[model samples]
Target chain A: MANLSALMLARDLKLLLEERSKAVAYTSSQTHSSLAKGLGILGFHPSQIRKVTCDDSMRIGTALLRSAIEQDKALGKTPFLIVGKAGTTNTSTVDLFIELAAIAREQNLWLHADGAYGASALLCQSRRAILCGIELCDCLSWDAHKWLFQTYGCGMVLVRHRQFLTESFGTTAEYTQDAAETGESLPNFWSYGPELTRPARAMKLWFSFQLLGLNTIDIAINRGFELAETAQSSLEGLKDWEILSPAQMGIILFPFHPHVPAANLDEVNMRISQSAIENNLAATLTTRVRGVLVLRIYSIHPNLSDDEMLAIINGLDQLAHLYLSRASKDDII
Target chain B: MANLSALMLARDLKLLLEERSKAVAYTSSQTHSSLAKGLGILGFHPSQIRKVTCDDSMRIGTALLRSAIEQDKALGKTPFLIVGKAGTTNTSTVDLFIELAAIAREQNLWLHADGAYGASALLCQSRRAILCGIELCDCLSWDAHKWLFQTYGCGMVLVRHRQFLTESFGTTAEYTQDAAETGESLPNFWSYGPELTRPARAMKLWFSFQLLGLNTIDIAINRGFELAETAQSSLEGLKDWEILSPAQMGIILFPFHPHVPAANLDEVNMRISQSAIENNLAATLTTRVRGVLVLRIYSIHPNLSDDEMLAIINGLDQLAHLYLSRASKDDII
Candidate 1:
């Protein structure tokens, strides 16, 4: 929504193309679906939104992005915005922000970092280095609910130039003239977002931070990293399991590769997850990596202990074996 | 945002207009700022949104709306939407929804009811008549947080057709194939709204309704109406005030009009509200009714008693006198 607001202002002021046909936006294949959904809401056609392919690390290739921009220009399309994912949901992969930022500067495209889940990692000194070039981006979105442990719907959008937001959303009317002319009070918050009557979403996070302190938050983030590392090492001991991607931040992707000739490994992996869910074990869902289904685990719960992690892994193994045995025997069918 | 989403769908499908130039939306001058802010976000210029004149009772004059639509058409603009204020935020005034709905039907325009605060009155048998033709609206936006007494940010949008939202927002991708093919389970909520990972806002309302029976909630709504009526009658007994609007869905609007050459009644009305706030009395505010500033009271707290209402009224009367007496004496000014 923030990026859409900026784009609309640019178009309204003739900074970008007045016609929708010439405007284009770039996003990595690993980017969250919300971006595509927002673009659709803003009246962008599927052809106007170009999904750039990611490399093995699931980061948008700078060379490929530059080529796509050149191609769009050659095709008479004006590229305007590039969205870089600070941490993707599927594999929790952080993009090459420094390189992406450089490209955005050279190409004059608005860079918005969709850090709904990963931006909070910047609180931890050990993990802050991973987001090296994030400061160079024009705007960034962060969801405090996901990482700061606040209640739901507490998302924040930060812009490098503060006036851009008000310039995009501000309106004048007799009812609101008093507040607007005061010229001394804080900006009317309604002029900064889509909604006029908004919830006090920041209060919850403010109280939480005041009570828990930043030191505790940093420790919780670091603990998540350590837990994911521990889970990966524990999974390495299981011969029938293949770790498709090692731990990043707090997420790991793996799939079941049993000894038996499983006709479909994707089906086997899905069954493993379904079996775990049916047994009421800790949830481990399946996501796609390069069009292949893999079981993904997000170990971000601060309350999770090593013993609990072991129990969940043991449960998955037992469930996978039971399903494989049933498949091999074919029962009476 | 919901209204904006529906408007965007109408424009995108060419049901409204093929381009932004000829498209226009009609809304009462008393409609909430959020709707106007939303239209602005969706690329509507200030000229594209026409604020039709309202009646003395704060209802949209249906005849005025019809002529406005005709004028826009004559000017080569296509009128597509007519928004009826189910309850204006300032006066809690209900528009002539039945007449507006009929005009929308005849003119082939989409009718949206902004009932964020008053729709919950439907649950009360006695007050439901005020929203006589609410069911005829094409879409309605209700804020559960306002009248349902739930936590903040629990708003709902009801579309006449179920598939319209999905058709507007749904996307096909390899990652979501499994759930897409099932076709028998619950709706993929992500496809129905803009955000992919929205907090479960409905759960709070569900729990509130489950814990508090319908009978109790109805009584609470009725109590709010009674409290406002009592406040209005109590204010009538005072000598230096005028009730601009009677109680409607728990909101009563009035202004201080003392017998003196006050010169600026708007400033006096604002001072009354400011004095109330400074004294730490009930948190009352001032709003405009027909271009005149008036003190508005929303007596929605169910636990407020008759005695407490009397105390608030007495406090206002005394505070108004104190300021007026200070002005009358011309002591040192």
Candidate 2:
């Protein structure tokens, strides 16, 4: 929802200044799919979104993004926005934000960061450097529910300049004039977002922060990094397991590719994931990286101990061997 | 939020079938401002919405709406939707939904009913007739928080055909495939609305219904009507008061216009409303009816006794007399 609000502001600003109805937005192919869905909601055609290819590390290819913008301009399409990822959902890869900011500045594009899960790393002193250039974004969407330990429905969108938000979402009606700001105080908060009668979503976050001071909260965030690192180190010790993406932002991806036919890797890994859940072990899931399916582990729970992480990884290795043997038996039959 | 979702579905359906990029929608001028705001967020220009004027009783002007649709059609614009009000916010007037449905049928436009407050009337067997033809709406947005006594953020949008909603909001991503349904039962709910990671909003409503049961809920809804009626009758017995709108759907509009100068009516009434708040009498507010500012009362509390309603009205009368006499004394000074 924060991404939606940022795109709304970007759309309104582009229309106001450029007056071009056929505006295009650029984002890395590894970025969350919500960006395209939001742009679709904002009435942009599917073709209006340019999913620029990412490099081998799943970081956005800055050169490709520049070329895409140039190509759009040549095609008479107005390139208005570049959505950078602080931490992408699939691989937890942080985009090259410094380069992205540079391109946005050169192309005169609105820079929005989808920092839903990754922005929470800003709480940790050591991990904060990974999101260094995020401050250069014109807008950033952070979900407190993801890494801040809040429940669902508590996400926030922030803009560099408050005027753009009001310009994009300001509302007036005959029935609500009494509640309008009197100019001596803060503006009516309704102008900041789409909702009019919104719940006090910030209250929960305030309570959490007050109860857990910055020091404890920072430690909890760093624990997420520690958990992911533990999973990566444990998986590196297991034979026939290849790390597809290293642990980053509490997420790691790998596939158990035994010395079997390469074509059977995806199915064998998928069964291992299913076996983990069936045996009541870990709730591991799979996601595509580059084009191959790999098991993805989200180890953000602060309560997950290092021993538990090691057991889950070893259990997955056992499941992979069992599944491979079963496949070989079926071939013999 | 419900209205926004309805408008999104309508926009997508229009784009899919008519393929008219330049589409217009019609709504009564008395409709909630959220309609225009939602349309704006959907990338519709302000001029694309035709706010057809309302009649003296505050119902939609059906003839004017038909003429407006005709004019837009004549200008090569596609008339894609008609938004009717089940209960308008200002005067609590319900629009002519049957006529609107007919016009929508003839014009091949989608009919959406904004029933944020009034749709709850459907629960009362006696009051349900007032919302006749609401069932004919292709889409209806009902807020349980408003009239159903749930807390805020509990609004539901209903569509006659569910496929339209899925087609409008369906999503596919590599990361969420495991959670996708196998088509053996209900579809993944994420496809039905804008939210992906939503709170269980329906749980509260279900608990309310389970504890209170339907009979108690019907009486509570009926009590809202009784409170409004009591306010209206109490105001009628007093002198120098005019009813701009009768009690309907738990709302009444009136102004304490003493034999003072007509030019001072708005100011005097506004002051009377302010004095009500200052004296801790009531929380009466002001709204415009036919360009005249009048005190508006929303008496939806089921616990408000008839005597309390009468006392509140009498207090407003006393405040009005006090303010008017003070104004006369100031003139003498």
Candidate 3:
């Protein structure tokens, strides 16, 4: 559904520009590939997609974006859509939405926030501030299946103006004409997205919200943030462990390196991840941070206790030690 | 899933044309709007989409398609993809796939069969012939949810070459490196479509097939065809009723006209549809045949008894009589 949202916004933006051949879209290189996939689906060529470099926190660089925008304009290219990553997939890093929104306003570009995994954070008072200026976005895509703990098929797209969606996808056939004009009392959802025969995606979100109030959902999200902090503090205490990205919004990116050099650091971290999977220890995976491979954890489960966090650390430490010991033993042989 | 399949194919075809600015796609005007929607999502302009006129049977006219292709080429547009409707939404009209395949082959264009509703008929030996030359198509999109008695979220896409899907959507991020190279033994589905985190849509189909067996599923589909035949025969016998399109592949289109002029026929059909919804009756719908309004019944449910089909006819006939009487009474007053 997040993809649907991006595609919808991109299509409207293109239509709004009247199919400018040189029209381009902008997003952080670290933002989820779904946005790029959606843009590609919406007929934007790979060359037309400008992936602006991100900062150390994996946030889009405002200066770099402005420079790229200016460069594109000088080259007779139209930059119309700018995406802000509210919560990146790699480390749950929230981009500087306020800064991005300001740039978008200055350039008259459509601002979209890909809050697929992080928009639920808005329900939590402590974490909501991370997504400052989110409301200023022209559109936002969020997934209830991700952080809200609902099953799949519950992603949502929010357009500042609802009519934009209807205008984008409101074409109806003879069979669908009645439903389309059923008035505001009956919303023909097919007019809002691509799929015509869609499953009731809103029901799951509605049921969850009804059964567990917003307060309860917020508490669950807050627990994830607490657990990430714990994981970060625990990693810092380890002698061989180095924090690549501090835990924020329920994710941490760290690498384990003892005597391993920078060249072999990626190899060791990869081996540890493989060992974790091989031993069925945990779901710890590896991602690159600033071109360096590192272990990444998504501490999003509300029920994950401190004991589980400790166990995860212990498991990683033991695996790393085993991998190093094995390497040393191979060398001796 | 059907949308993803079409978009993937459309994107690859455009890329194959080396991002030709004048690339165009062809489909019957009677084809599902999803095809056009997918093409639009893939960046094709409304002008690039050539909606070829359909024949009386509502199938795509091949002569018109060939002429359109020539016209587009003459206009410096490269026609890349041509979509054939296996079972159109309105009349269950199966396009002349054999003729379409010949045209696609002669022109070297990618042929995609939008069989979302009718492809399941392939499981029944007696009904498979309706989709003759289906094997010649480059790609096909089918929905298991529609006729296979599976729940929603069960749509399948078949490509002539396995590598095409991977070639279209096989990019990997650092975080996805481990899963991307899981070897030939394990298929990474994310590399085959736009979605990364998709629900296990195949499980429902798998369980249905395992529990009910292919033979039973085939029988269910055949039952729908039988009921459609029964509906066609029944509708033909009714006085003042005209059969717009004969029952084929579990769909029948007809209109009841009792002293009603051609001008208000559309209104009458629409009113019947609205009344069906308001009265909480069967899910009856209306469609257009050669710009004429008609009521369409999809006899897709396997357990739709002969009695039920008769009851639907009776209800529609009674409603038509009531509408005509009310009109005459208003004229007299």
Candidate 4:
């Protein structure tokens, strides 16, 4: 259903493709465009979404919100699909869930919280504020794997009401529909969402939950954010490099800068991405910036610390420095 | 997506049209008017779907498959959706998967195996034949919770080619797209099928697997099949009752004696289904032969023996005997 939710977000975001968020807390000047495309898939016309800006960074941060009120005013109920990321994937941004839930309740929208990354913080006393009002929202999607230490594809889409699921996709199969009170009494997963033959993947979460209490998970996740702060401090010495979105969990995005012309930044970044693989580093490279590519180094293991993160940063810097020195040697000729 | 599958099945069954799945999977057998609707969705026409016999169940068994060949000769590779049940929720009928897979390979068809129940028994060496040819098929779906001790929604949809998933519902997302990657590298899960924000429901299966190995699971599922067979044998002992489908898995179907009066039997079975909540027994009531209702019992545990199954059968008989005796008293008056 998160895929469906993302599609709805894409449908709504096409207007200005502005960086709109569902939450009122911590409005940013920039967010990822993936948010824009998420709104476009839900049948929202491009004209329905309008982009507004917050005074954040120019290139890296593009934060704006598509107000649900604008939708409710035009369509009455505004039957929309709203997204509230538990933790934003790119920038580790957390929108105000309580404020968004209030808006969802009053405006009559389908509020689906994308808690894929940050939801595990709910167990954290310090970060409980981040997950505020998740219960009030119509749906909450969190990735147990990203932060909660569940396996990959351990994502969730929890609908507030059982009827919403049944109303959305209930059907009877002659072959499978037992005339007895099979699902008429309870919610069958088949009627709830987009999958029928899905993996019995839920066991990982149940196992982890049983093996380690949520409190332990809470500390571990908080530790990730805690580690991010240390990483930010450690990288401050590197003048050429820039931290884009400081780590929410362990994921910290920073672009490598060479002491070369701006035109070659992209080319060098691509080289560094390949170099990371070639050199057998722990970090894999992904692009969040338009021209500038970033390498994200974050994993679930608590063993990773500031030293490991810095080693990667140092490796990238060394590679860029070498590339720039060769270029300068040619320039001197 | 399973909901859509169910909706298509429902459309084939013709009941509620509240969901998109129902709208998508409706077959021509029941909702004949909507026969061509799916083809149109797949970019085909009404005549594209081969018409099979509605009245003749024998034609549907295998000969209808032969008829599909003529259509295959013309289309080269027909985009077809096959619905097979490892255990049909109603009857527990095991479709011949290997035979269908051979025919599907010959026709180059998209064979979607729907083993929502009985497929859970593939872990059992004795029952493995029921799930044969699964790897060769284009896609397969099954729900683990129905037969296995796993929680609900632990389903699966396996695709043979990763390209099939990337192409069928390929995405055009702003955030997920790479200007450099083209159509080749790093295909996101969103492109693989449907929905964006989802849950780590996979862990549930992992938990079940960990808690109870596949060997245990196999034993449990085959035990359920054994219970169904026991019930069938006992019902066959009763001279009046007529078994409709003595299927392979947990569900048992038998008319309340087609030769005998059915009104009293219908009332008796409905009351039995209604009273099952209070009784706390093993059996439940289900209707399979259209409006005709019957008592269905399933054994979902490996520990459950033939003796226990026979005891439940005796209990159902005692309830029916009491109800029928009361009906006779009314008739005499």
Best by TM-score: 2
lDDT of 2 by residue, A190-219 (tens): 788888777888899999999999888899
* DockQ values per model: 0.40, 0.66, 0.55, 0.13
Q: How well is candidate 3 docked (DockQ)?
A: 0.55
Where in model 1 is the C-alpha error above 4 Å?
A1-21, A171-188, A258-263, A331-333, B5-17, B171-185, B331-333
Candidate 1 chain A, which ten residues in sequence have the lowest lDDT sum?
Answer: A8-17
> How many residue-pair clashes does candidate 4 contain?
62
Ranking by lDDT: 2, 3, 1, 4
- Which digits, one per residue and each the tens of the lDDT, describe model 3 over residues A194-235? 777777878888998999998999899999999989888887
Best by DockQ: 2
Please write out the lDDT profile of model 1 over residues A102-207, one tens digit for every residue: 8888877778888888888898888888787888887888888787887667888887665777777775554454466355366677777666556787798999
> Which residue pairs collide, candidate 3?
A41-B41
Strongest candidate by lDDT: 2
A87 in model 4: Cα distance from truth in Å? 3.3
Rank by DockQ, highest first.
2, 3, 1, 4
Q: What DockQ class does candidate 2 belong to?
A: medium
Please identify which of the two predictions, 1 or 3, would achieve the higher TM-score against the true structure.
3
Residue B137 lDDT (model 1): 87
Candidate lDDT scores, in order, read 0.79, 0.87, 0.81, 0.54
Score every model by TM-score: 0.91, 0.97, 0.95, 0.62
- Relative to the unseen true structure, what is the C-alpha lDDT of residue A121 in candidate 3, on a scale of 0 to 100? 94
Q: Give me the runs in candidate 3 sitting further than 4 Å from their true place.
A: A14-19, B1-4, B14-19, B271-281, B330-333
Candidate 4: tens digits of C-alpha lDDT, residues A1-333: 454443333223222222222211212333333344333323233344433343342211222344535543465332344455556565656666676666556655555566667677777788777566676765566667677776556766665556665544444554334431364565555555444345666788998888888777777877777777666776678767777767565667776665577777666666666777788864455655444566665554666766886686677677766766776778821
lDDT per residue (tens digit) for residues B1-333 in model 4: 432332233222222222212122112132211123222222223444554433322112545565655645464443344444444455555555676667656654445555656667677888777666666655555666666676665656565556655443346532343433454564455555444434556678888789887777777778877887888899888756677767466666765553335555666666655555457765375654555667666667778778877787766666656656666778821
Candidate 2 wrong stretches, greater than 4 Å? A16-20, B16-21
